[model samples]
Target: MNKRILTALLLAAALVVSLVGCSSQTGGSKPVEDAKTQFKSEMKFYGSTTLAPVISQLSTSFNEHYVTWDKVDSKFDKKDIAIYVSGAGSSAGVKSIIDGVSDFGMVSRKVTDEEKAKIEGYQEFKLGMDALTISVNPKNQLTKLKDSLTTEEIKKIFAGEFKTWNDVDPSLPKTEIVVVTRDIGGGAHEVFQKAIMGDTKVRADVIQAPSMGALVTKIIENENAIGYASYGMVNQNKGKLVPFKVDGIESTSENILNGTYKVSRPLIVLRKGDMLPQEKAFMDYVVSDEGMDVIEKLGFVPNK
Candidate 1:
């Protein structure tokens, strides 16, 4: 090959490579169903840990079927170079989006007015609905908590004021009561705290579990312990757990949707400001019919 011609050809190739990199934001691209190509880029998705199961499962299936990756390393083996997922809690998810650390965030509750102001062009799209369910060990005969606990009563329980099952009500056995709760930053935790304790903080004696699994385990193992979580989480282990009544109603889907459930909250995904093209496409997929089926099957209320 002539030296001059070779030099010009190398320049052209470099230009092409540069354009591809910029287009993908990552170093690779893969085809999807319907002959579409979703750019494999370093997109981080964060939010509700409750959503981790379904989203992680579905994202895996998506990658296998329609996306490919530029696998960087373990603990990060994303097939679709465009996106990766990370989350601690729903509140954390929303915070990450607000902080611009995540392309999207998952949440189990509506964005508070204060949160809305953080991102100038914020938009919230409903993925589904979930309920804040209070759970007790199967052995605890107390079926459910009151629809709302007086702030004083809540403080009494968490503060060790009401330390026995019989203390709350004489009909129950004399069992040492323990409170297992989520970290204050969790979205559902916030709801429960607000609803039951009002402005009061969880008492110093309250046991703070690291995650829902830990909280559930604490409740199940300790017959006297009680904890709260999204209804789906509680029900999946319902064989060993008993849900409580709030007021006069049980924590069934029917009650939650019909206004009988006082703690019903929307499960959502949020994009920062107005969504980008890719983010919008992903969001639309989540709200579509097939997407909704997963939500319902997983014990959530579809936005539909």
Candidate 2:
């Protein structure tokens, strides 16, 4: 072999080896880039009006702080991903997931055995704890009832046994009792019925509102109205409605965390079968410390 030819061959071989080494290094980083791209899209969350605010805030924060790959380096762009949160009630939310209409469903109560039967291999992620508040118009003059109402008294009011405020207590004025309740399918309604009403039936003539917001509105508009709502909603409307003590226990975050609030329920997110990478990431963020901060800030008890 010629000396010049041998030297040229060695140099060419060295260049090819260097190129292969560079390719290996770049290929190793593909997974991280793929993960970023996989999640850079829209996410849909439905159900539980009580959790909608928290989901909305978390979605905003997640989009603002998280970076994604775009064929180059990581970059944070709000437009890269979008999260839409809506509340049609917990049952509807679960139905949305089973029907493939939503990526995630939010529920403020335990998943009933019947709901579980609707779909196979669904998973529940508990995000936080919430308490149902027995709310009344702030201007209500039932001072005795305002201070505290025993479980029996609450049951009586809803059962139509107590037709007037004076029937609850002699100290209270004689006025027609107005009861506001959530629609039958509402998680709040189910919880209220189980926890407070038990086997007792609510009066047939009682006014029923479709959503917590509407129930709150009805309570605020009628001085004699009493209804049950999530503590977060009642806390948000402190001046408009009074969250009365039940059986001498107030529905505060502390009480809920300590198990003293009997009306408390779990706030959960539901998904079917295995979770997509994006869904898992969002669920992880919701249980992370930063996510718990958002939960606590919205007036609910964080699971962690």
Candidate 3:
């Protein structure tokens, strides 16, 4: 062979070897990532306005950390681990999962047996703890009269048996007690009814706020209003409202975690059948220490 031609052929061989080595190193995980993406690229969650904040924040963090979701499987090139979350209500959340419309349903209360039986493969993941905090407007005079109420008294007030502040206690005032609550289908409302009202029904005339934030605002805006809301929601709005003690126990984190508080419930996620790879990755992250940090930061008690 000519000397120049031989040198050119040698250079070409070296280039081929280098290219092969590079491909082997980088392309190893490509097939795995592609397989993972086929299982799921985007995840959707709906239900529980109360749990929405936690999921929404977690989704943002998940997207940032898992540009390639190596948590559930081998890393691949950037797959859009798009996590979509919405909060309609807890009942709506359960229905969404059963109907196959949502990847997961966020529920702030326990799932009833009936709901569980409706689907073929119902699964739940408990994320954290929250309580129903009975709150009154900051300007309400009942706080001066008493900071705590017996379970019986609270029940009567919600049941419409105690129609006025004076009815609750003569020294309080003659003002008609305005009962406020989250509209039906909310986890907060269900928790409140089970813990306080029990067999008794809530007043027909009760003011129903559509969302936790709205319910908080209603309590703050109406001096005569008394309502129950998520402990985290009320805790976040501390100065804007006043939370009452139930049966003499304050709704503190320590009290809630210890089960000393009567009104608390679990924060949960629901899905049907097996989770896709992306769903598994997102859920794994959700229960991780970092995920628990998000729960704690939001004023809810982490299960850990």
What is the overall TM-score of model 1 with all chains considered together? 0.75
lDDT of 3 by residue, 1-304 (tens): 9999999999999999998778777884343346544545678999998999899999888777656555446753345667888989898999998898988999988899999998778888999899988888888888888899889999899989999999988788789999889986577888888888888899999999988878888888889999886788876886888888999999999999898999999999998999865678689889999999998888899889
TM-score per prediction, in order, is: 0.75, 0.79, 0.82
Which 10 consecutive residues of model 1 have the lowest summed lDDT?
A: 68-77
Model 3 steric clash pairs: none
Choose 1 or 3, whichever is better by TM-score: 3
RMSD from true fold, candidate 1? 8.7
Better of 2 and 3 by TM-score: 3
User: Alpha-carbon error at 44 in model 1, in Å?
Assistant: 1.6
Best by TM-score: 3
Q: Which of 1 and 2 is ahead in lDDT?
A: 2
Clashes of each: 9, 0, 0
What is the Cα-based lDDT of residue 103 in candidate 1? 81
